[model samples]
Target: MSVDRSYIRVKAMLVSPNDDGSRHLVSRNAPTSENPLGFHRLIGGSVELGETHQEAIIREVHEELGARILDLTHLGMVESIFRYNGELGHEIVALYSGRLEPAPADEGGTLTESDGSVVPVVWRPFDDADITVPLYPAGARNWIRSSLT
Candidate 1:
């Protein structure tokens, strides 16, 4: 069965903070024309058919990072409308907060996507100044910032 790229997608993502809550895990994306410097986003993926957003988040984290999420808490939702590569895309994202079990190293690591492409994963401080690579789903970033204060 093929999925429609133009249709708005429903996704579940996690805001996984490190032990001290000073940093969060993010996946670095390749540079696109819309964002020449590229960008970073929280780890998680699409909510599959018949899956709850919470269940989707757990499955996605395990699949994307081979890690488990604990103490999951519903953060909120955000609508993302943007372009990737050259195609317009839209997503309604359900966000959650949690901690990663066996967190990735401070030096960061790589994670393979469902498409088998490997991307770098890193722990970034909330105050990171590289605005060129802003955290995506702008609303998600705002939520994280508000929670940190």
Candidate 2:
């Protein structure tokens, strides 16, 4: 058996403002992650074969957040070289920002993985991301922060 390596991947940052008038970023707890941390811990994933980056984002939102994005504007591309568990990994991930049309009406309060994995999504202000979540691809965190400018 051979390892399946993905040289390319795509994702989206579906964000919204909380009732307290603070912004929150969203991310999906990856299937491989056993314990995922904070808000950027909301919804996202890789682009499937023949699927465009935008399509993957849409699919991810539906599957993870149960919410459709009214619009997704390209934020930027993030090239990342990082190590996880001591293994070096590199990726050029396409990043985009979308406005959630409305709070997801799904009965579940937290996002669920399609594979039956469940991790709670805890919303935190942008300023709190560092203290709360362990965002991957370091560049993505920077892109998200810069896009708000």
Candidate 3:
């Protein structure tokens, strides 16, 4: 059985600075994390019924990590046609670059799902966070490499 979901979403890739001023990205580890395991996801979800892209991003960050997102500078958008969890999925993703305000670090933030699973909010090293990983999207990867110079 192949499940199909076609929708639009907003992604907030938070650039958090280390004590030395180098930046790292915050992400969520996928439930099905495997192989290389333990990577943060692009922080966003479905745009919801009537929310604007910006609103959606903020809401997603808050819900997922309980952190208030700020300075959401729009990156770009992509038409992603891909397969997810053995299913076909398509998403129009609007990207944003920003930081978390009063954001938890040192492995502080976490999400408790309805099933009582704890999802860790990870601060992924910048170099390690690329398209080669399972979570980072190709579109954002290209934009990050080309535009964020």
Candidate 4:
């Protein structure tokens, strides 16, 4: 069998420290037919042609969460292999660490995906989240924690 080519996915991740000094994260899981096992994931997407990883992350976070990333930092990339809908998948994931600038209280934010899927976005403490849902790429939690330190 021929091996699958690498698919690149650019992700924008934010760990925001609230006034109480506790860090909260923004995550979502838009269920698609192709993704049989549903789980919440980081806010990110594919890097389009001619666009750089930084550009894609910025665009994705804005398009998906309607939030802007501030003091963005490149935390490096993580590569992994997995399966979706019984098909093997390989991804070169560009992971970014950043903080979300406070959104205006007047407007509620939303997510816009390529498939027109709407997933729930939730913010919770780092420790409180890992138990509730399985995060993709496995290394995301570590990176998120490292961002705040």
* Best candidate according to TM-score: 1
lDDT of 4 by residue, 6-114 (tens): 5544444444444444545455564545554466666777777788888988888777768888878788777757665566676667777667765422223346776
Model 2 agreement with the true structure over 1-149: per-residue lDDT tens digits: 22234454444444443445355545434433432442244356667788887788788877876777765777767776754434455666667766665664333357666675665565546665347446555666675566653
In angstroms, what RMSD does candidate 2 have relative to the true structure?
A: 4.3
lDDT of 3 by residue, 34-120 (tens): 425544556666676777888877787777667776666887786666555555666778877677766667677675433446776
lDDT of 1 by residue, 5-25 (tens): 689999998888888888898
Q: What's the alpha carbon RMSD for model 1?
A: 2.1
Estimate candidate 4's alpha-carbon lDDT, on a 0 to 1 scale: 0.63
lDDT of each: 0.85, 0.58, 0.59, 0.63
User: Positional deviation of 2 in candidate 3, in angstroms?
Assistant: 12
Better of 1 and 2 by lDDT: 1
Once superposed on the true structure, which residue ranges of model 4 sit more than 4 Å away at CA?
1-21, 30-37, 102-109, 128-130
Clashing residue pairs in candidate 3 are 27-40, 28-40, 28-41
TM-score for candidate 2, please give it.
0.70
| TM-score (C-alpha, index-matched) for candidate 3 | 0.71
TM-score of each: 0.92, 0.70, 0.71, 0.72
> Once superposed on the true structure, which residue ranges of model 3 sit more than 4 Å away at CA?
1-21, 31-39, 112-117, 129-132
Best by lDDT: 1
Runs in model 2 deviating more than 4 A are 1-8, 12-21, 27-42, 104-108, 129-132
Candidate 3 achieves a global lDDT of: 0.59
Q: Total clashing residue pairs per candidate?
A: 0, 4, 3, 0
